[model samples]
Target chain A: METLTTPLLIRGRGVVSGRVEGEALVTTQTISGWGGINERDGSIIERRHELVGQSFAGKILVFPGAKGSSGWSAFFHMTRINGVAPAAMLFTRMTTKMALGAVVTRVPAMTDFDADVFTEIRTGDHVVVDADAGTVEVTRR
Target chain B: MHLTDTEKAMRDGAGGEAVAAAMDLLIRYGNALGAERLVETDNVAGAFNASTPSVRKIAENGMAEVFSRLNLDSDKTVEIPQMAARTCQLITGIDDQNWALQGADPQMVQMQRDSEAFVGQRGVNLMATCTPYQVGNVPTFGEHCAWMESSAVIYCNGALGGRTNVEGKESTGAAALTGRIPYWGYHLTENRYGNRHIRVEVPVRSMLDWGLLGYFTGEMVEENIPVLEGQMSGVDLVKLKHFGAAAASSGGVEMYHIPGHTPEARIADEAFGPNRAEDFHVYDAAARKKMYDTLQSAEDRKVDFIMLGCPHNSIEQVGRIAHLLDGKRLHPDVALWVHTPRAIRTVAERSGYVARIEAAGGKVMSDTCPAISRRLPEGVRVIATDSAKQAHYLPAIAKVQGWFGSLEACIEAGLTGTWKGDF
Candidate 1:
């Protein structure tokens, strides 16, 4: 486990209201919903993805938004059922696919962030997402 | 967000536990999408159940519970009620009829059947196809609908001129129960206008050419409405379907327009709104050829599987295949599968096209395709397809070498068990 100092605060609209704390996993590439993910494990399986083998389970996933197919929500729904879903999700932009994924996953999700989430958040940073207040507290560790 | 009195009543549990739960999910989904209000759609077009590994693991929970958790986004299990609008099941994981041919286990087949029966009993028209529009679920122009399946969404929005967003399984299910969707996205008049202009400089005649153009355009423009200009005369439903399906699969295009062909796009100016389009593109012969080359994975490999009817084959396409394979038998090693909607298959059966294909050692399947079902026969190394959507997706989903060509080329490959085309 990593410890933290004074945390940096960022705000956004809380799409799915809840609170969760986990390590941050940030990516600029939008994930494909159809065959982009491995459902058995929560790993990104798209051939050219940056985080090809990294698991999204129990992390605070940060991305621009979803891409590819409307099948995005169903794959994420599988992640939740397998107990391998992200603790929370943060998107710089929101699309119908990503929004529906957040809703169905029933996780603490926030989108339309005020800051550049890709730059401000790092892979190992401990982050707390308060979807109700539309804020995220990131503790660089 | 504003809800109508009826919507309010349903949200407040007036319609029953199921309707209330459905409303709650829709409200949240609408809010997340920044929808101001809910709009009543005349008919619910399609609803697909999630067929992921997790859903299969909990098969014993029954379809209602699976529907509640996966579709309704509710933790508490709820019984599914009769859909408020006409609803059809989209593609499932297993082929309902030809499970053994696809090498599915008996247990998996039984589970799929059980779920199908459960949903069927609840008044869902169990068409079990990706191309529901082919089988009497066609929404008229400007009709607001909630539809799943990427290819169908593009066809509904681009070719048929029906309004729909690229709806997810959950949202489609919710929309089926409530007969409504968030009044936003493609449902709005302003969002349908084209933002990008694609000038076609190449002669695109065949379905394969249209598919290549679509693949090139989709790769170039992601999530932007493209208005195509140039030679689009005599573009039929089959061409439009292949074009839109390829675009939707390669990119996230829910809708596209050909200036003269698409309903909303009579003139290029109207399609681009008041201002000139932001992005201008010219697709020439070189680009078309380049895209065709890119889709073909291997030229010399022996194709073990040849699949057609990606967006679900039209009856005309099925007839063409039967004509091509009239007296020729497929290679013993090659498994040739032709897919179409069940209704269209019924017509094919009556016309003896199904029998002809079967006599040629090929199977005319329905309700599923290899791309969605991900159930290719074991030990299959190379797969050939006429559909750009299938070629693009099968490589990633099924981990096979994909060769893409025209329907004629696919038929030839099926006959010889090898790909000799140089496209």
Candidate 2:
């Protein structure tokens, strides 16, 4: 919603298949689901986190991976149930917590990117995630 | 993603609607992880209780609805079937024995009971503490398990050599119904070797020392394996539980090695067999002091609550706390709760540890911790704990200022109602 740039294409292994477009919310730090976010509205609640108080609802959340408790999937599942889940997810690290979380959140998610997604994309960029095609198209703002 | 005939049949509804849903979830979960196939498992530790406020509305529709939606990740509610594997519960939000002290609503307490009864009838052993290993679910070396609770996952992998990735609520629920989890991550032997090496330079003898070392190791080597070398001794069930829990909380360390001490690693070479330590780090006195500093999240000197037995304390920890508080009473403004397994609390009661603790103005609670229950004594703003894991999490989870220290320091803070801690 800020600026326009030529669309940049990136590829990765799509884990959960779907297609959606939304503004990007990128964080290089891994997210902690259980203590990290408020499920009611998808706001980062972890005190020391860089994105504290920022809500990821309806945005394409781009992060490094998941950390913290095994409640990662459960909490993310709650976000979906509460109707505040991210529009799509693009993460770099692959852990059981992140995998199951992406699956249950049931959004278009891809990982193992061909390029560093953190460098290629910034928060507020328009992101089109075609998980079935294993592609992410980024338009910088 | 490769399923056998039986798995395919289960996915196709051979085992009924709930099991079919469970299998479908597993397939989706497995495929998402890029797993090669489903592996059979008889041991499953998961979160099945429906006590939390999040699941209260669903539990109203019957426990089946809660399991279908939360556990199985299926929208279609069906009659829940008995567990296919030997399953047990993990920590929950309500402490049955001390719900009143926790300020829990009585109706939610009843809901927990009803939810327990439902799962208990379905062959779910209600080992309601986080440390199921202490309560007789000690997995054997090389035993495959599907489990939740990050602390327990590390203990299972690093301490017992039992294989399991840190599974989640939905995955573990499906695993219990189907007795199968995706064969990936720690399930394969090849993935069990140590990658990061921590060469300790200090005398890591006491529980405090071990805990601080664990915190440093986990922060340095997040979810990967860490090999502990040098000055590591006096490792026991309680110490191992604390160390693993601290590591898991600070980062996501699911496994580590102590050379000859652990089950898999008879020696350092065996710990890193078929591999080499990718990086070498040191845990010296400075590192230890830094870890101690990192855990100090509180600025206020007045302490309000003191929590012990994170990962649920062992019997000895309970007894030690009892012995320390034999005659002293906590400050009237302070509330202290020492947690242990229900089974172990029974033993403590028989040994007169419970009465001693109560006389000294503390409660020996079972089945929950403040972090899991997300409950605390009313008006608690600043807390102290003997558990590094609790110190690492409670501050973020409860929005309370927290202090981290040894058991003695925590007890001193409790008795004095002030933070004059020594690290």
Candidate 3:
């Protein structure tokens, strides 16, 4: 296997580093589109979701983009209130909902990574995503 | 990122609180999607939910109060024509008959009132429906916009080729206040192309079928915007509206491409910009049927709750329902509700549509829908609705069997109290 240094480095001033070193929970499926996510509780409510019942609390979430509604950010805001928000988010394409969610959730998020990162990343992969450098480093547990 | 002088001024805090807050969000959103600057958008369409009591308390006394204290109301204006109402039951408790009299958390009531006042004072028009495009906020292809409706985001992005992110409520509110948005996602020309190509093999004969196809497509695509191709043909604003809401609810996609319907996808390769992905396999009829069957109730029980208007019903839509059930009576056991904006309800009443619906034993409700309405009237089971948007969310809200279909079918089921036929 080829060891890559940075799948892609995306830089932005908004990125903030909170508690670091967390497990990466990747989903080709982004978070709930509508009110599927309970801000009161950070549980995923999209019944058929692979990550159903999973919490974004402290996990580095890797996703494609925000789907569904603009309400996408509010649910994430609720999660922030409950203290179960993600540590960071890495998106292939950044949508407004995801961006707003990141702001409200106050988590470090880096988007517009190289395409290869989407293909290579897997759920539960132990990775370090540095928002300051806008780099996502992944290593299999 | 490039910002016009006004946008720069707003970002620089010369534009007051609402604009500044919006600027912060726009800047962050722009930076997130690699947008170099802000674009000037004169017209902005928005959809934001009313906060719950506890929720509003925080926003009002905590956040909104700060705005009032600073005397920043005059500069904020919402160019949009509408907003989507959240659950009213939150403001009106379950047992309370009249919403204003209901013991909904006082804070919730204050919040809704404050939001409504804000919308009114700012001239937001308050259409109170999910599909603002149905009312007036139609964004033409490639026009930059900020909207809160996810389904509308997908429709504008996919069907109309308009640019918008399924932006959050506050950001949309901010955009309304500032008439600007961060250029990214569907806003950017490069991102509008379809990533995964999907083909439809099933004959989507009815609106319900189309909605089901959208739900399945949303599942297959997940978060990625898909360029949908196949024998699937003929999608209108109404059909796209319903399908888009379902897709947005099921998937978080703000944009999608229907090969022929969407402006960008008039031809296949055109939608992909320059970066085209390899051909993805077609979704077969069996898969489509599987999705439809899954959405349909497995049990052949009688529906006790029949609700119309998820994404909130338009005046025309409500009038159509009233026409269908002209003289028929709803099943006594079933509670029938048709939701619309209070403004539309006034029109419906003035036009005698409300009387017809009410005479049919159905309630033409306003200011709430099942999804955001604080509570579903207690003891509602086997909920049925004509809206895929409503159907998709009601199963969770009702926590029981939910059926979706046409207005005629929903009425029939409401009359018979059974949603067993192939509606």
Candidate 4:
């Protein structure tokens, strides 16, 4: 395999700015089909999270897919209602839950990323994401 | 995704506005997930936030406002054993401020209120608790169902051997009204069997313990459906419900199986279907206990809040509490909330159970539980519950000591206003 430096090339506006770039919270872990994400606090509260306290407020959040209950969408809806939401999101593939969350949050989001993106990115690596062109710009910093 | 003529027709506005809207949403959901086909569901179980009086009021108030604005009749649903809206009315006279603390969002709360009101006035079946399975939304083995609770999805898939996906709330609502969902993910036959195996050497006793085990399994497994060969006979519906809730809470599992209990898994090999069980984990008793311990804190102290019923309470469960607390009063220092369905509460009221519990200073509420709204009492540092599900989820919302115990212990805590970990 060719050694790829900048692994993901994702493009999206900086909803919140800190010049902070991390790899990506690449999760095979699907977001909850129900109240998995706390919209008010913008934290993942699915309990089994390794990134329990980690906030999606500013991160290149990526997931294999969205799963679980219908209330899943409402969680993000609640987050926006509380004014705490993700900066950007990347769906390795999309689910209705993620779509609803995207609609509710109106954040920069892209999906249909290559399946190999899962193997390429790791949580807390440097990458840039663009939602408009559906491309994630990546280079491991 | 390929839509059949019927599905196409429904999408073309033949199945009525509700069906058309549902079809549109299902189509979009399918496209998003790369689903190639749409599936039909006979039943769906819905769960949303119903934790506090304020949130409940918001839901009711919002619904009332929406119904007035839309000029839509809320009474349009066919009554089933599970369908009852009175549960939403339980918070009628309670303090509103307590609800504000439970993370009630005005907009969504209003939306929920409106939707719930519309649903109610239209005679829609009000199944508001997260775990609808407990409320008689049982899909026969292999019957397609859409459920909003993550754990319910897993349990329905694994234990009940019903077909479903951990479909989102809106998707489920869409499917519920229209009776269709994109037959994409876990509902597919290819997705039914287990890819991972959990070999249990543990003594999984009660529903709470099973719930703890589910949390453990959820953490251990990824998105793969798990086939668990353990103390299967010990599993019951309530325990399975708690397990499903906890599993969904801990990880992403749409379905799971306990060998004998779940329809699919008559035995371990059956759960794998045609696949050879290669990937597996051995879970011992100690491991199970450790999982239980992970969700609980050892600190014993006064709990300002004690909420029972995570998947909403069954009539029997509430009746038991009412009987237990007959003539007793809840400590004024403690705010005790019991979540259940309105119909069940009505039964409780008729049976004089609600009054007994109410007279004892506890409340029997419906539509909301402590988990969703995050509506807990203020100035409360420690919290306790008999529900492993509530015990697990509440700490995620606030900094508090989480304690787990039996229902008797929980009610006792409610009475004395103490959350001492020792049951």
Better of 2 and 4 by DockQ: 2
Q: What is the Cα-based lDDT of residue B103 in candidate 4?
A: 45
DockQ for all models: 0.73, 0.86, 0.42, 0.34
Q: lDDT value for candidate 4?
A: 0.62
- CAPRI-style grade of the A/B interface in model 4: acceptable
Which tens-of-lDDT digit does each residue in B46-127 have in candidate 2? 9999888878888889999999999999989989999999999998888897899889999999999999999999999999
When only the first chain is scored, the TM-scores of the models are 0.95, 0.96, 0.80, 0.74
lDDT of 3 by residue, B237-289 (tens): 66777777777776666677776677877777876768675557467777766
- Best-matching candidate per DockQ: 2
Clash count for each candidate, listed in order shown? 0, 0, 22, 58
The chain B TM-scores of all candidates, as shown, are 0.96, 0.99, 0.82, 0.79
Q: Against the hidden reference, what TM-scores do the models get?
A: 0.95, 0.99, 0.81, 0.77
Off by over 4 Å in 3: A1-19, A22-28, A62-65, A90-93, A111-129, A133-141, B47-50, B59-63, B66-107, B194-202, B223-234, B256-277, B280-285, B297-300
In model 4, the runs with Cα more than 4 Å from the true position are A1-36, A40-55, A63-69, A77-87, A91-135, B9-21, B47-114, B121-123, B297-300, B326-332, B415-417, B420-423
lDDT values, one for every candidate: 0.84, 0.92, 0.64, 0.62
- Interface RMSDs of the predictions, in order, are 1.3, 0.9, 3.7, 6.1
Candidate order by lDDT, decreasing, is: 2, 1, 3, 4
lDDT digits (tens) for residues B66-124 of candidate 4? 22211111122212122211121212112232345454556555555555555566445
Model 1 over residues B1-423: C-alpha lDDT tens digits? 899999999999888888899899899999988899988886565555534455676667788888887777788888788888778888777777788888877877787778778778877888888888878787899999888788888889998889998888788888888888998899988988898889999888888889988898788777889999886555988888898888876778888888778888788888878656788888998888888887877655788999898888999999999999999999999989999988899999999999999999999988888877888877888989999988887887887889999989988989998897645
